[model samples]
Target: MPAPVQLYVYDLSNGLAKQLSLQLTGKQIDGIWHTSVVVFGKEIFYGQGISITSPGQSHHGRPLQAIDMGETALDEETFNEYLEEMRQVYTADKYHLLDNNCNSFTNDCMGFLTGGSIPSWIKDLPADFLSTPFGAALRPTIDNMFRGPAQGGSSAPSSAQPLASSLLQSVAQNATGVQGSTSSYLPTPAATPSPPLAASSSIAGPIQICSNTQHFNNLLSTHKAVIAFFTSHTCPPCRIIEPVFERLASEKASAGVAFAKIDLGSAYGGGQIASVYGVRVTPTFLFFMGGKKTHELKGADAGELKAQVDLLTYQAFPPHPHASLPLRATRSISLEPILFTQSVNFEAVRSRLFSFIDLSALSDERKKSIENSITSTIIPYLKNKADEREGKGKGVNTSISSGAVCEAWRIASKDLIDNLQVKDIFPLADLLRLTLLDNPVAQWCSTTAAASGTSPPHAILERVASALRNEQQIPKPVLLTTLRMAANMFTQTVLARTILVTRSNGHHTSLTTLAISCLLHDDSLVRTAAASLVFNMAAFYQAPRMEALRSGRRGEAEEEGDGEWEVELLSAVLEAIKMEESNEDVLHRLVASLAFLLHLSPFYETQLKPMLEVLEARSTLLAKLEGVEGGFTVSKKEARALLEEVGTKLCG
Candidate 1:
């Protein structure tokens, strides 16, 4: 008997009961209260009840045993009757049962109206609940110290007590039907509170939030925005505002204001992400302007959060309101017309986002909602731009303010490049197919720069490259061409960036392969460019690649001679390099690249003899062209020595 199973039911929604007793609730047990179970009414999280008693003198004397000795369920109405009956049947022995036996678990709060001490269990519940990591990794890790020892750490365990309680309280109050103590009851949420809104006209305060470029792209595509709070459980100010967020997420769900929370990475020194947003403390709120960041709030309150949301959503998130009033409060909101009017076809995108009326939270549904919102708003804008170029007369320069000419080129001829697809892993082919080699998305990506008030083509390119690098699926050619063009035009970035990106294992190609390509290219610039990346990429695979070559040649006579593969590959590389040898500006990367290749696999032994002969002949020919004459000069001499060093590395 845990002090004889004395039941104390309390309702937080009603002030009198809450004041009379501390509340015990989770979504499993919210607003409704009951002692006697009736199918379903709210008596959740009743973990196994323990029959606590005075401990025996032995160290492991079986912790308090559980017994249903006086277990009872009371529905609100029946509970009232039960309470009345209990009052009548109350005796001195029951009071003694609680007063002396269970000090850790108290019924003291049971004597409510008059002040009484909180039970140890009530105080410890939060820590115990947090200790269980169920459905919680994605949730904000509010506390830095949440990992401290369970009970013997001397100091009190860190618990976002107030915030946790608020979260529990809201969930409990909103929940309607819940199964009781029995394990076999079918579970289902009878009535779920509506989720929060996705719009903001500005809840209050001038705040700006900056998103990484990818998120910026997604938001602009959907014509949507969000207010995010970066916080931690250990942060005092964050702890204070978390309750405000829980309250706001529920109360203003109908307002279309979206609220999100993020916990900084653990390595960030006690949640120091505020530094990126330029705030030095916890509880920083930011308001986003379109996809760009607008302002930051050093501290936040509920009113401020809600108001900022209301303000941003009304003024920024939506595209245009419709002509007719909705018959009911709908999950969808009209986009503001101002957004579409600026760009002739942007309106199509607006209608698209408006079509996503997901009033649910299943993962698949949520993914569809986000995807639909993006395609609807963005595709139309792209189409309109396409239509604008209908008859600009072939060869007529199409670089308007939006730069439609080059885009028209990519559109008129997309077949030159291959489009790739990976089934069921979320199709990105559609997105890649839309990429124009003459640079439509990058240019439109440039408009994002206007939103950011700076040309972010390089930043955008870097982000795209970063995304592409890790993509295990081969990238579509049009996308590669478009990015390559962007890299070229952004001259400051191309060489170093291409080299930087080439080293990444995202879809690695060997230096030997590129060297072979450069030797055979049609254009000097293209060949030179490929050769440069080959140099850097080879460094990472150097010795291992060299060893593989040596091993492949060791049994040349016994080989089935897939020599045609090597012959074709090397022929292509040499042709590419020979074509680009005209550009003196690229000579260094060429020589250094060749040097890098020769350094890895010796020219005489581990390679196709014909390709090396072709490459050396081309180099010797280039050296003879005025100052470009080449007989593997002193520099080439040094490079060859380094090659010798690489060849002898294993022997050493």
Candidate 2:
């Protein structure tokens, strides 16, 4: 069930800004708004980083008013995961007064929770204040008040007299802008303290604060490598190296290594955590691998610390198999999805499509309606989209609506497939191939699911595949155009990945049926397009394999079925390689597809290599290479090298 969300708005000036802002800045700013999101009985806000407490009980005290902001379908666990991602971007060091603040944080949370934004006045307060003459002049002074030594290159000025004298101090103190404590905008003592740790998961950027033994152990067990920093707030040396520790965490945490900080003096269980690890110093670093301490460094030495971190990460994740390969040409190949983005003559295409329909078996009424839709809606939209893509759009108001295009596609696809001849369907498929290049139309087609009255995502791709499979001999033009359309589906990566690997009503969809069939096509164009589609699929599975290699969790690929997909893709690719004789370009693409599928594959040892041995993949490739005419080109040389590397290194 969805939960109610509210925005807790506070007046950072304690209502004094309202009375004095007109005289001080000559701007009638109502209040210096500080906001927090209230949901699931927790008041979550960003201050010394993100904090969670009982509703209306954060250090800001009770909010002046709580604005109800609808509800969210997202559950707590999913929401927390979103917050974990945000922690990387919204670290304490990144906070700013007018730039990024508590209100901005609440606004972001509100959008995630309710698909809505906070009241504009609350979030726009800073901009409004900054636009004033006096406010503009004081921007640097105000920013310097909160800037720490690491950021400002000097000790932060005392908030006591930040503006030089009493009058300036009073105004500066009242107008501190947003969240963190500049000595002026100190947090009011809360009746109840905020939770010590927002989460135990390994998030990037900020140091992961561990408050208990179990929490610390959980971080260690989950990550392959962890660096625990023992520190205390009272120690000056801890402050000196804290920034270095944070910078390294940001750099290395994404690679699946965890960085934890345990404060020896704290109300939470940080002291207990330090005691368990026998840490008594202010800035001690302990490197743990597989939850066992391997190295330790006391005090701050930035160079040695970085060296140790690099050593630990290297020991943990190591390098991917492809890293050792010397295939220069293949390494330079771009993995971007092949999209058909030509600004084709929509009027000419529409006329050709009408002529094709006229020769088809469609009823007269259906023909008239379809032609009218092509003339009035889809053509205009495609034209506008083309103009926009070429930076020729006259203005925003002249743009055509995408909703009309989606509806027209539904009607045209149904009518054309149901009534037109298989050979004549190329025009319609060609039109859709062009239409799918438009981002709005592609996004809509990617996400729309089959419902009581709606068509499934990529229905046209499936329809085209069905024609190829059911017909005795599909038309070459139709097959080529359809294959191009299938390749274009990778424009939306999630849509292509999800739809291709999935079964609909218990049968193979276009991926296993259409792409696999066209893989060994007699026509090089059709086969090249099919190889592109297959490369997209291979790249999808290859991503998790790479992540698994980086994080020292190679077993995860098997558990998640990534290995199964690689084996299935490779079997078809190997068959294609055996039959493919000439065309270096097609062979190069096929070899690159193999690289994505076979490199770092978890099934390499158990399933993939055994299959390769049975098929004699190396001998087949060598035989193909032996037939080259004069000499090997750079592409063919790299292609053979890639194939050889796979056969010897991976399969051996």
What lDDT does each candidate get? 0.32, 0.63
Residue-wise lDDT of candidate 1 within 234-301, one digit each (tens)? Answer: 68877777767655543332112334454542221113334545655567777665556666776757
Off by over 4 Å in 2: 1-206, 213-218, 236-244, 278-282, 286-308, 340-368, 380-403, 410-425, 449-457, 464-474, 492-509, 539-561, 600-606, 628-652
C-alpha lDDT of residue 373 in model 2: 78
| Residue pair clashes in candidate 2 | none
Q: What TM-score against the true fold does each predicted structure earn?
A: 0.21, 0.61
